[model samples]
Target: MPKAKETVLEIDLKALEHNYHFLKSKLKPNTKFLAVVKAFAYGSDSATVAKKLQDLDVDYFAVAYVNEGVVLRDSGITKPILVLHPQPVNFKTLIERCLEPSLYNAKILKEFIAVADAENQTNYPVHIKFNTGLNRLGFWESDTDYISEHLKATKAVKAISVFSHLAASEDLTEIDFTKTQIKNFTAIADDLSSKLGHTLWRHLCNTSGVLNYPEAHFDMVRCGIGLYGFGNAPEYNTELKPIATLKSVISQIHKIEPEESVGYNRAYTSNGYEKTATIPIGHADGISRQFGLEKGAVFIQGKSAPIIGNVCMDMIMVNVTGIDCTEGDEVIVFNANHTASEFASTANTISYEILTAISQRVKRTFLH
Candidate 1:
C-alpha cells in the first residue's frame, strides 16, 4: 500500500491470509480451524476480515456476543459461528440466527434449553464449556451428571462440542499448570461423553496452545491473536506476519525553544531547541495517555521520534529533531515490522489491548 496521506489503519488481507495458512500448518489435516473474530476482528473491520477468512475456508468462527454473530451472518458468513459468552436475553435471537451457544453453567444450560424448546427446535447444537483451569466461565467436571441428565431430558439441545481455555499457554514457566489444565479438560470431556452416551468433538487449544501443546490440539483449534499476526510469544511471532499497520501523516511541525511546552496540561517542557511533529491521533484514537512525555514514539522517515507531551484527545506531539521529514510525511504508529506489541509495551500494555482499543472512527484501508 502507498504511504498514508491521512491517519489510517491499513488492513492487509494478504498478510492475514498468510497468518491463517501458517497457523493451519500446525494442525493435522482434519483439525478444524476456528477464527475468533470478536471485538471487531480485534479492532479492524470484522465483516472484511471475516469475509477474507471465509474465502480462505476457515472451518468455524467464534464471537463474544449474539449481535457479533448476527453481523457475520449478515455479511454472508455461512460457516458455523459459536457465541462464546451469549446472554440469556439474546438466546432467542441467537437461535434465530442459527448461532451456536457455549452453555457453560447450569443456569445458562437450563435457560437455553427452555428457549430452544419453546422455539420447537430439534437437536440444536450447543457447546459445553469445562472449567479446567481458566475459571472464567465453564462447568465443573463433577457437574457432568447434571449436564448429562439435563441434556438427556431435553431433545431441544445436543452437545456438539466440549472445550476449555488455557489461562497461561503463552508462558512456558506455567507449562505444568497448562498441562494440568489440558489433562483436566480431557478427563472432563471423557466423563461428559460417557454420560451423554455419545462422543462429541472437543477443542481445548487457544493460539499458544496450538503452537506449544500439539498433544492437546483436540478436534479443533481456536485462534484469534495469531490470526491477526501475534503468536503470544516472540518465538512464534517470528513465524507470523502482522496484518494491521497504523499510519498517520505529520499534520504539522513546530520549532520548540528550550523550556517550551507541548500538548495538554503543558506536560512536556523542551530541554533544548527541538523540532516536533504533530500527529492527528490521540487517546481517542487508541494511543494511550500513558504514552505521553517521551514514553512512546512514532517512526518518521526511518528514524525514531519520541512522543513528547501529554497525549491529547485528538493529537500527540513527537520530538522530530534532526529528521529530514516535514509536514505530510508518513508517520508509523505501529506496523508489521515495528509491531503493535512493541508499541504497546511503551505504555505497559499488550497487543490485544492496543489492537482492540483502536477506535472505529479511524479510516481502514484494506490491502489485497
Candidate 2:
C-alpha cells in the first residue's frame, strides 16, 4: 500500500462483514440481529455501515439519538430504527421519521403517547427499557405494572419489546452477577408480557452478553463493538477482524542532543541524543493528550516508536532513534496488526473509546 499524504481512517468492509457473520453464527437462526450504528457507527460512518448491514439483511438498526436514525432514514434506510435514549423533545421528529423510541420512564412514555395521539397515529411501535442492574436508564422492574397500565389505556403507542442492559457481561469473574441480571430480566419480561396480554420481544444482551451468555438471547441481540471488530474478551477477539485501520505519514524527522526538550511545556527532556519523527495527527484528531510522552506509540516500518512529547492539536512527536524510517513513510497508529484494544489499554481505556474518539475530520477511506 502507498503512503497517504495525510492521516486517514481506512475502513475494511470485508473485515466488518467477517465480524458480523461470525457473531450471527453464534445466534440461533430464529433470533433477530440489531446492529448498533450510533456514535457515527462507533466512529466509522453510520450511513455507510448501516447500508452494508442492511444489504446483509440485518433485522434492525439502533442509534443513541433520534437525529442519527433520521440521518439513516434520509439516506434511504428502510429498516426499523430503535433510538436507545430518545429524549422527550425529539419525540415529534422521531414519530415523523418513523423511528422507534425506547421509552425508559413514565414521563417519556406518557409524553410520547401524547405526541403519537396528537399526530393521529395508531400503534406506533415503542420499546420498553427496564432497569436490570446497569442503573443507567430505564424504568424499574416494578414499573412494569405501571407501564402495562399505560399501554392498556393508550392505543396511540404499542410496546413492541421489553429489554434491559447487562452491567458486567464482559467480565468472567462477574458471571454470577450476570446470571442474576439475566434471571431478573427474564422474570420481569415474562410478567410484562403477561400484563400486556401478548408475547413481546425480550432482549437483554449487548455485545458481551451475546458472546458470553447465549441463554439470555431472548428474541434479539444488540451488537455494537462486536460489529466493529471487538468482542471485549481475548478469546472472542481472535474470531473477529478489526474494521478500521488508522494510518498517517511521517511529516518530518529531527535529531536532538542531550538535555534537549521537545514539544509544548518541554514535557520531554532527552537524556541523550535521540531521533524523533513528527506525524500529522494529534489530540484534535482523537489522539488524546494523555497518550503523550511514552504512554502511546505509532508503528513505523513494523517497529514501535514511542511518543516523546505532549500531543499537539494536529501533530505528535515520537522517538524513532533506532527505527529505519524517514519522512513520508507510512505510520500505522493502530490497525489489524496493531489492535486498537491494545492501543487503548495503554491509555487506561477501551477500544470503543479509541474508535469513537477518532474525529470526523480525518479522511475516511472505505475498502470494499
Candidate 3:
C-alpha cells in the first residue's frame, strides 16, 4: 500500500482472506460459515467485502436490515442473505429479493407469514431467533410452542434455521453465564425441533462463541468481527490480521506558542511551545469527540502524536512536537500496529464501535 494522499480506509482483501481462512479453521469440515456484512462490512465497503467473501465461497451472509441485503443483491451477491432485524414493511421486498428474515417475536412472525402468504410463497425460508440470554431481541424459550404451532399452521413460511445470540461469550469471568445460555439454547432447539417434526439447521455462535465454544457450533456459525481481524481476545488476535487500515495525511502543520489553543472551544491550550499537525478527519469522519485532549493519537513517522483539543466535525489536530513530519505526510489513525482496538481503548470503547463508525466519506481503497 502507498502513502495515502488523503483520508482513506484501505481494505485489505488479502488480509480478509487470511482472517476468513483462520476463522474457518476453527470449524468442522461440514459446518457452514455465514459472513456478517452488515454496517457496510464493518464500515469497509460491504459490496467489495461481500464480493470478495463470495468468491471465497462463504456459505451465507448476514445483514442487519432488509435494505442492506438488497444492496448486496444489487451488487450481484447471489448467496443467501439473512436479514437479522427485518421490518414488516420490507417483508414483501425481502421475499421478492430472495432475502430471508429472522422472524424473532410472535408479531413479526405472524406479519411475515401474512406477507409471504400474500405473495403466494411456498416453504419460504425464515430463521427463528430465540432469546437465550441476550434480552435485546428474539422470542422466549416458552415461545417455542407458539412458533412451532404457527409454522405448522402456515405453509407460507418455514423455520429453516433456529439461532440465538450470546451475551458475554468473550468474557472469561462470565463463563458460567455463557455456558448456561448455551445449555438453555440447546434445550430450546431440541424442544422446537421435536415440535416442528423436522430437523432445522441450528446455529448459536457469533465471533466469540465460535472461538470459545466448539460444542455449540451446531450446523453453522455466524462470524462478523473475526472475519475483519478481531478475535475478541488477545491470544486469538495474534492469528488474525485487521482487514481495514484507516490512513490519512497531515493537511497542514501549525507551531503553537505557549498558552495558544487548538481546535473548537479552545479545548486544548499549549503548555509549552509545540508543533501540531491537523488531519482531515474528525467526529464526522468517525473519530468521536471522546477521543481528544491527549486521549487519542495518530501515528506519524512511526511516532505517537496525541490528539489535542476538541475533535472538530471535519478535522483533528494532533501534537506532533517531536515527530519529524511535514504537510501531506501520511498519518495512521489506526492499523495493525496501533490497532483500532488500542485506539478505541483510549476512549473506553471497543473495536466494533470504532470500525463500524468509520464514515462513508473516507475514500476506500483496496489491496488484494
Candidate 4:
C-alpha cells in the first residue's frame, strides 16, 4: 500500500515491548501477564499490537468482545484470548474461533453450556467473572451457589479461571476498599474451588492492582492502559513510554485582522492581528468539538499553538501567528513532549477516552 500523505497515528512497537517488560519485571516469577487489546488495542490497531505482543511471548490476550478476539485469531494470533463481555448471539462464532468467554451471569452460563453441549465440545475452557466491587458486569457473591451448580452440571465445559475486577485500584486512598474486594474475591474463589473439587486459576489484578497489591496477583494480571504507556499512577510516568503519537500537517494559512471572527458560529475572534493555520483534522477525525474554542491545541516547531474557533467536521484552526512555518508544516497532536494524558486533561476527559476515541479513518503508521 502507498504511504498515507495526510494525518497519521504513529504506533511505536518498541515502546509497547518496553512497557510490557517493565510491567512483567514487577510481577512475581509465576504471575502471568495478559495484554488487553480491546477497542482496536486502544485505537492503535489491535492486529498490529496483538501481533507484537504475541511475538513478545505475552502469556495471554484480552478483548472486550468476541469479534475482537476473532480479529486477533484471524490475524494469526495463537495465544489464549479472554473475551471480557461475550454475548449469547456470538457464542457459536466465539467457540469456532477458540475464544474464551468470561461468564458473568447464570443466564449466560447456562446458555453457553447448552451451546457447548450441542456442539459436542468437551472441556471448553471458560472464565467466571465475579462482581468484587465494580458493580458492572459479573456474577454477584450471592450467586456463588448458582455458579457451583452450573459448573457441576456442565461437565462438558471446564472452568479455567475465576476472576474479578478492582474498581479503584489506582487510588491509594481506597486501599481499604481494595483490600476488601481482594479478600472477598479470594474467599469466593476458595469456596468455589472447594465445592467443585478442582483448581481454578484466580486473578483480580489489573495494571493498578498489580502495582498496589501483589497478593491479589493470583494467576494472571491484565494490563491495558499500562501496556500502552500510562501507568495509572503519577510516580510511574517517568518509567513508561507512550506508544502512540498523532501528527498532522498544516493545510492552509490565513491572516486574521483584530476583531475578525473565525470558523463556524464565530466561536473565536482574533484578539489581535495574527496568523491562523487550518489543519485537515477535526471532530470527524476524533478531535472532538470540545477541543475547539480554545480547549484544544497542537504543537508546531516544538511550541504550543492554541486552537481558535469552532472545530469543524474536517478541519480546525490553530493560532500560528509567530511560528516559523508554512503550508504543510508538521503539527504534533500528542507525543513524547505532550502526552495523551495532558491532552485528555485539557479536554476534560480521561486518557482512555482520548485513545479509543481516535477515529479509524485516521491513517496508522507503525514505527519500531
Q: Give RMSD (Å) of candidate 2 vs. truth.
A: 0.8
The alpha-carbon deviation from the true structure for residue 196 of candidate 2, after best TM-score superposition, in angstroms, is 0.9
- For all predicted structures, in order, the TM-scores are 0.99, 0.99, 0.99, 0.98
Candidate 3: which stretches are off by over 4 Å? none
Candidate 2 local Cα displacement, residue 261, angstroms: 0.6
- Which wins on lDDT, candidate 1 or candidate 2? 1
Residue 141 lDDT in model 4?
A: 81
- Report the lDDT tens digits of candidate 4 across residue range 209-231: 87888888998999999988998
lDDT of 2 by residue, 26-54 (tens): 99999999999999999999999999999
Error of 1 at 214 (Å): 0.4
Error of 3 at 289 (Å): 0.5
lDDT of 3 by residue, 1-368 (tens): 79899999999999999999998999999999999999999999999999999999999999999999999999999999999999998988999999999988989999999999999999999999999888999999989888999999999988899999999999999999999999998999899999999999999999999999999899999999999999999999999999889999999999989999887889999999999999999999999999988899999999999999999999999999989999989999999888899999999999999999999999999997
Q: Assess candidate 4 and give its TM-score to the true structure.
A: 0.98
